[model samples]
Target: MSKVVINSYEEFERLLGQQIGVSDWLEVTQERINQFADATLDHQWIHVDVERAKTESPFKSTIVHGYLTLSLLPYFWNQIIEVNNLKMMVNYGMDKMRFGQAVLSGQRIRMTAELHSLVNLRGTAKAEIKFFIEIEGQKKKALEGIATFLYYFC
Candidate 1:
């Protein structure tokens, strides 16, 4: 999908209350899951130990970490929109985040985002986006949250 380009805050504000876009599907590979485990030092058996997880896990396989899925927000968000002429951009925070389901390794996930609100804070813009990370062919979302970003446009 083509990115939704926003050259200015006004352009971004225009998308309020609208479903901006959906990102491309990204596979939750075991390699990526293991890498995240190593990076974070969260070597839980459900995430890193493939053989144990196959027999012990309710999902019957290794599952991706919740934080690992949440960390993909930026990657997925980048796929949906591109804001140019920015002096800086900050990940302000996230609110009301919930993990609805476990993402099994090798499953594909994609994000769909809506512009929840946009506030002009002096010269900076605060954008609140409602996002859902959907597992392929699943009714339940892998994760859902409202993410806020601070953008300084030049």
Candidate 2:
């Protein structure tokens, strides 16, 4: 596929609602979950206590932190498509966010990003994108939400 260069406001607007590629699966390992738990100071039993979780938790194993799922957006976004020739791009904010399903540790997940909306912010272009994070080999989606970003051209 061709890379989209946001040269002008009109060019950015033209790409709205475009279909981006889905990312490859990223494994949610127990160590990664623990590290994230430690970093975030959210040392909950459901995410960190694997032994206890196996007996008490319905998942029968440790689960990935919700923020971990959210944090994967950048990695997933890179896999979708390339937005070239920009001085910088910044994450503006989320218009909407939803965790459709919990991600269990040891599961693999990927994202499908669709361009949702676009607007001109002063001279920069802002894009609102919706990302659906699918859990591998499962019907449940781990996460789905809209994220906004501001792209400034050089």
The best candidate in terms of lDDT: 1
Which lDDT tens digits does candidate 2 get at residues 16-101?
Answer: 78865678889999999988988899999999998999999998988899999999899878866667768899999986688888
Residue 141's lDDT within candidate 2 is: 88
Model 2 bad stretches (over 4 Å):
1-11
Cα RMSDs of all predictions? 0.6, 1.9
**Candidate 2 global lDDT:** 0.84
Name the candidate that leads on TM-score: 1
User: How do all models score by TM-score?
Assistant: 0.99, 0.90
The TM-score obtained by model 1 is: 0.99
Write model 1 residue lDDT over 63-132, tens digit each, in one string. 9999999999999999999999999999999999999999999999999999999999997999999999
lDDT per model vs. reference: 0.97, 0.84
